[model samples]
Target: MDQRQDILAQWAADQIEQLYQHSIPAQMVTVSGDASFRRYFRIIYSENGVHKHWIAVDAPPEHENSRQFVDIANVWSNAGVKVPSVLAFDEAQGFMLLEDFGDVLLHPELTADAADGLYKSSIDSLIELQQIARTDNIPAYDRKLLDCEMALFSDWLCEKHLGLMLSCDEKLMLNQVFETLANSALAQPQVMVHRDYHSRNLMVCKANPPLHDKDFIGIIDFQDAVYGPLTYDLVSLLKDCYIQWPREQVLAWLAYFKAKSAQITDINEDQLVRDFDLMGMQRHLKAAGIFARLSIRDGKHGYLNDVPRTCEYIMQTARIYPEFAAFTEWLESVFLPALNKEKMA
Candidate 1:
């Protein structure tokens, strides 16, 4: 192991000893990490003849906020959304011991036959999370953050990834499109948004008939939750970048979520859908840029594979609106060809 891993393992050993009254086993396996800098380790040990497991987190305080993660876990738990319980933590050292949710990611297990019900359970959990009512204390997804996220498209995806130097006209058009998307997002009702509420961050607890009996899916990677557009999390769930659903099915789930959200909040279901569509465009653009940044900046090239699908989401939305016509054409006639050439070369 490297120096950093050694230090983390030592900290994990100490925490495990305090929690279990024994040192951890010599074998600790690394869990697959995400776009973020955090690392997770799975520890399995026999406790009184029963094999038990726990997750140890190395968040590296300089990069991630472990305190916010723990606080959000408590908030989500209180809000009735199932999240990994924080077993132990050392904020200064950026280490945490958490309850293990096993390895059943919602992404790999979801099939057409089972998607309807699983999605329903996830929607219910999302609604529960949104209805927390008093979220004024959480950071707002304000205009500054929204615009900065959209700028990543030009900064990372276009310049850094594609190595494109846009003409002044092209730059102006992109800026206008970004502004339109930002305004549309700002128009929506704000709620608790789990920033990365996609399938990959969800854990399927039971794959049976009684799926909704308890928390159907365990929520994770929610340290970046914000008070943002009501439809943000819904779009994240229904219009997932990693997985594609038919437009009909997408609308069906959108309608279902709209109906559920209406009961709790004062929302016009019809207008809510327009917001959903626009919000999706904003998210897709941001996601594509993030994936590009992950590849170019972080040296995690696997995420580059998801960029095309994310771009398709942007194009799909852009084509429907006259205002986005110029930007849409640029993406199609200019950006996509460049992206394809890079992939082929």
Candidate 2:
């Protein structure tokens, strides 16, 4: 092993020994990682002639915050959300041991027949999660973060990746659009949001488990949870960046969530639908920017493949609202053709 891998292996061994009194084996397999700096590994062991596994996380303190992950895990788990249970943590070393939720991701497990039932389960848990109190202690998804996120579209995606040098008028137009989107977000009711509530982060647990409640769906990668706009998580789930659903189906789910959500919150159905659509536009813009940044800065070119789909969502949403007509024209005439040309080449 190289120097870094050698250190990680030793660290994993120590964590396994400390947590479960089990000796490390040579069969450590690397699991796929997400967009963040964290890395995951699966440790194989035998118990009663059957093989069992646990996940080991390598989140460098300099980059990722394992403490917040632990805190959020405890909070969400206590609040009846099916989040992974934290088993052990080494703060200084930036290592954590988490309960294995198995390999069945909600994305692949979802088919036309299963979508309704699975999404209903997810929305039910979301309602319960939004009702959790003590939200004041969690960091707010304030205007500053929102502005910074939108700026990435111009900074990394437009200027850096697409090589677009914006003229003065174009810059002003971008600012105006960003402001409008930001205001739409700020007008909504605030609730506890699992920032990345998409299909990939959700796991489909086995039917027989210690926790029956979690068997329907298991949530992970929630260290970035915040008290944010209520519509944010709903949009993230319905208009997922990693997957696409038909507009009719998405609308049905939106209506379903509105009914379930209003049972707990004071939002009206019409307003909730409006909030969900506008919030989805903002999220898609942010996602496209993030995907570009991931490719250019992190050398993760795989995300570039999803950029077109994300931009398509933005254009589609823009066409729906009369206020966004000009903005949609700019996107269609100026941005999308360029993106398509590049993709085709």
Candidate 3:
């Protein structure tokens, strides 16, 4: 183990022993990490003839928001949301001891036979999540933040990664469409938006023991939660970047979510569909840009593989509205050719 790993293991051991007086310290096994700078490890220990594990997070204070994670986890956990329990944390050192949700991510479990049931079950949890009242700690997904996120596509994907210099008309079209999308988001009924709520961030807890809820799903990587448009989380799930579903199937699930969501919020069928479509375009633009940035700046090239799929989402959604016709044309003629060239070379 390196210096930081050694420190994390010792601190995690001490924290676990404090919680269970007779617990014996064991080796800290490495666990997978997410897109951000956070690294995770699991320390397996024994107490009362039973072996258990606790996940230790190494989120550098400079890069990640450890404080917001603890605050949001506590708030959601109290509200009966299936978030991992926070046992102990050292905010100064950026280490946290969290309950183990185990290794089953909702991403790989998705299949033709299993997709419907898995999605419906997750949608059930989402309805419960949006019902939780927003607090001061949660920020608003305002126009500024929305615009800034969309800018990633132009800055990273177009200019930096693809080496394309946008024409004057191209920039104007993007700016106009961005304004329209952000306005649509603001006009919707605001709710708690789990910014990165998707297959990778969701855990299928079926094989693991049910501790938090009998429902058997766990949510993680929620430090970026915000009070935003109601359709944000829904669109993120159905139009996931990691996986794609048929358009018909996606809208079917969208209707299911809207039917349930409208019971709590004042959303009708037409408005929900428009909101879901527009919200997806905005998210895909941001996501495509982020994926390009991840490859160019962060040296995480695997994410770029999802950029084409993400852009296809933007194109399909753009076709629904007449105002986006020119933007859609630019994406096809300009963006796609550049991407294909990059892939070839």
Candidate 4:
């Protein structure tokens, strides 16, 4: 077992003993994922003639954000989103005992046949998330936060990963693009945006059936929820980093989401399309930069393979906007070719 597995095993044992206060037989099984800072384990315990199992998330206070996870999980759960129920949490140790939602992620369900239905349902869940995000009670997804994330693209990916220094004009263009994207995003009606609403973060519960009031979509890794643009979560789902859907399917889902939004929020369809595309571009760029940084700085090379697709998303989106004509030209002539060469070599 690795260090993470060992820690999780110990945490599970401790939690069963300390928190549950049951001197019952307990077994711990580590779950699989590419998690960096946190570890997850399923704990099975038998007590008082009943058998129960729970997922124990061991975040190791120094390495992860357990508090945010607890807070945001509560918020989403209260909003009728299907997330794991929190059974118990220890903030100091960053250990959370949560309801086990089973381990079937949406990634394996993305075949050509099931793609349409899965995406349609996924969009419905996303719309529900947007409706909840629009509430003023949630925290703001302000300009500073958006700009800070955008800056990571410049500082880490452009300068550090690609070793390209932005000229004055290039910097101005970058700023203008991000400003337009951010303003458009911020101006949109706010909602509870799951900053990382992707396939991996979603779980399909087979063991425990969903409640009537709750959604079938079991959301996880949503600690970074923000109140921002309605299109942000939509883009995250449609332009997913792990799995790629065909353009036609992506458009169909987009149209479905637009109609849903119009019905709920009375937003214009064309503007929603523009916002989705622009937000996708911004997100793709950030994802590419983060992927590169993860490889170079964090010593995680698995993400490097996904950089090309992320860059492709940026290139594809840039082609649709006339305002980005110059940037698009530069991307095609300079960035795309260079990235391709790097990939091939």
- Candidate 2 lDDT tens digits, 199-298: 9998888754556633668889999888888889889898998888998898898888877775435776667777888898888888888999999989
Quick one: best TM-score, which candidate? 3
Q: Rank the candidates by TM-score, best first.
A: 3, 2, 1, 4
**How many steric clashes between backbone atoms does each model show?**
0, 0, 0, 4
- Expressed as tens digits, the lDDT of each residue in 1-345 for candidate 4 is 666556656666776777667654445687754536776778887756967678877787887878878877777779877788887787887878888877788889778897788778888888777666454445678999888788777777777877777799888988988898888888777767888888888876664543434436678888777777777888888899888777777878988877766433566667778888888887887788888778887798889888887888888888888999988987877677767777777
Q: Which is better, 1 or 2, measured by TM-score?
A: 2
Tell me the TM-score of each prediction against the true structure: 0.93, 0.94, 0.96, 0.89
RMSD of each: 2.7, 1.9, 1.6, 3.0
State which candidate, 2 or 3, has the greater TM-score.
3
Q: Candidate 3 clashing pairs?
A: none
What C-alpha lDDT values do all the predictions have? 0.85, 0.83, 0.89, 0.77
Highest lDDT against the true fold, candidate: 3
lDDT of 2 at 324: 85
User: Candidate 4, 174: how far from true, in Å?
Assistant: 1.6
The digit string of per-residue lDDT tens for model 3 on 1-345 reads 889988988898888878976455545889987789999998887656987788999999999999999999999999988899999999999999999988889999998999999999889889889999989999999999999999999999999988999888789888999999999999888889889889999999844455643547789999999999988998899999999999999989988887776443566677778889999999999999999988888889999889889988998988888988998788788888888888888
Which pairs of residues collide in model 4?
133-191, 133-192, 134-190, 134-191
Task: List the candidate 2 regions with Cα displacement exceeding 4 Å.
Answer: 18-21, 24-26, 135-137, 262-265
**Deviation in angstroms for 241 in model 4?**
1.3
Q: Report the alpha-carbon TM-score of model 1 versus the true structure.
A: 0.93
Find the 10 residues in a row with the least total lDDT in model 4. 206-215
Residues 12-62 of candidate 1 have per-residue lDDT tens digits of 777778877876654568987778999888888876786677788889899
Candidate 3: lDDT of 251?
86
**Which has the better lDDT: candidate 2, or candidate 3?**
3
